[model samples]
Target: MAEMTLHTELPADMTDTRGLPGVQPEHGPWLRVDEAYAAQIARRIALLDDVPEQVLYLETASQGAAQELLHEALNIMPTLGFTVEGAQVTCPDGRKVDVSSTAPLEALGRCLQNDFVMMEKRGDEHVLTGAVLCFPASWSLAEKAGRPLSDIHIPVDEYTENVARRVQRLFDGVQVGRPLWRFNQLWYQDAELHQPRSATAPLRVGSNLPDGPFYRSERQTLLRLPLSRAVIFVVHTYVLARADVPELR
Candidate 1:
């Protein structure tokens, strides 16, 4: 069973209507270690341990990007108060994780709260080559793996043709170091975190209910790997009770 995970507040602005690629240039820190860091990291570690095949995927060719991702993460995390000692990183929650090159994505999964997905242009579109996606809102890695951005959002009704083309262009134009970000909020009765739904199956509950117990938001960011030219998709998920969510500022 998925654990009951909840955050105190939505990290980003939630007043805007949900739309395709409502992106803004990101200036501040990207990876966040929130109040739910300890619990969420524990959940992530448990998921990785219990369901490796289901939660993690690294294509043989994508190894370089994965290693670069780990290197990038290690560089950013120390600024967020994480301690790096040789090969091991001590998180703010005081948990120690090794800098495992052989399993760099797993190392990233262990330390960071955000899930990382590596996408590279294969022919005409960016494909989902690799990911350590433990907290999928309502999508599965098995189905979305190797699929392009347009195919990945097949189940999302709002992701139309124009939006897909625009998103592809955005992915193509995104530069290294300069990250573009967007946020999405949905109401859900279930806030277990690892909510992966297959493409074949229909959602048990719709995301647009007027009232729900939990408010789930994903702070999604896209950045390019300097060497591989693969776009790194990062998801920082936050779930808060309806009552805990503050009114729009």
Candidate 2:
């Protein structure tokens, strides 16, 4: 939850692609946000209770990772002014968060703005054990829970031939201290952050620009937990008005 410096100024070269073309993830996946949008994060966290089914899911196997993630968040977000006293987390703005009273996964979700997905290794593939995905791109957290990586991405175009195998290999080779991230961009009809549309939702091509007022992008990062050997996937969603994004024109 450190302030994101990179996004302090609006990005200029944003695109407006509508198709799910092949993914090309960069080597180093973690992004540093220099500017902190405290109000937006607070708003998203507050909305979580109203959309529990759309936002959080956890399996028995993921409980340990959930706790570990909560601990990690408490340690990393100190710059955002978080104080941990025993089981309580106090935010910069004086909102007290009781970690012990809330579910581990939910506690982790509420503390940060980014949505998190916890993946556990099973044989050669990674399984989606748990998540707090309040701002889904175009998928359902409930349906993806407990599914393998490949199965979870079944609806994505060109996933099998283009991104699936590579993602699996990346997960297997990722080390505990090292983290990596990449970006995905698309145009959306609306600018809301909590989009839980199914994969079958119609694509909004550039020709359909009149209907889409927002240009959406996600900064996705992957990190491995040293203890649980689980991978934590974090997605920070960004939405810009089409008028603000020159590429949309």
1-249 per-residue lDDT for model 2 (tens digits): 212211332343234343333233445324333344565566567667777777888888678889998877777766556778888887665778899999987886777667889999988799999998877777778778888998888766657655777778888977887776655766676656666766566754322355676666777778889899999888877766655555432
Candidate 1 residue runs with Cα over 4 Å from true position = 1-4, 12-14
For each candidate, what is the lDDT?
Answer: 0.85, 0.70
Model 2 regions lying over 4 Å from their true place: 1-36, 200-211, 246-249
Clashes of 1: 0
Count of residue pairs whose backbone atoms collide, per candidate: 0, 13
In candidate 2, what residue range of length 10 has the lowest lDDT sum?
1-10
Give candidate 2's whole-model lDDT.
Answer: 0.70
Taking the tens digit of each residue's C-alpha lDDT, what string does model 1 give over 1-249?
334568777654555655678998987677878778888988999999999998999899999899998888888888888999878899998888877644988899999899999999999999999999999888899999999998999968888999999999999999988998888877887778888888888776446774878888888988998999989989998888878887744
TM-score of candidate 2 on Cα atoms, chains taken together: 0.81
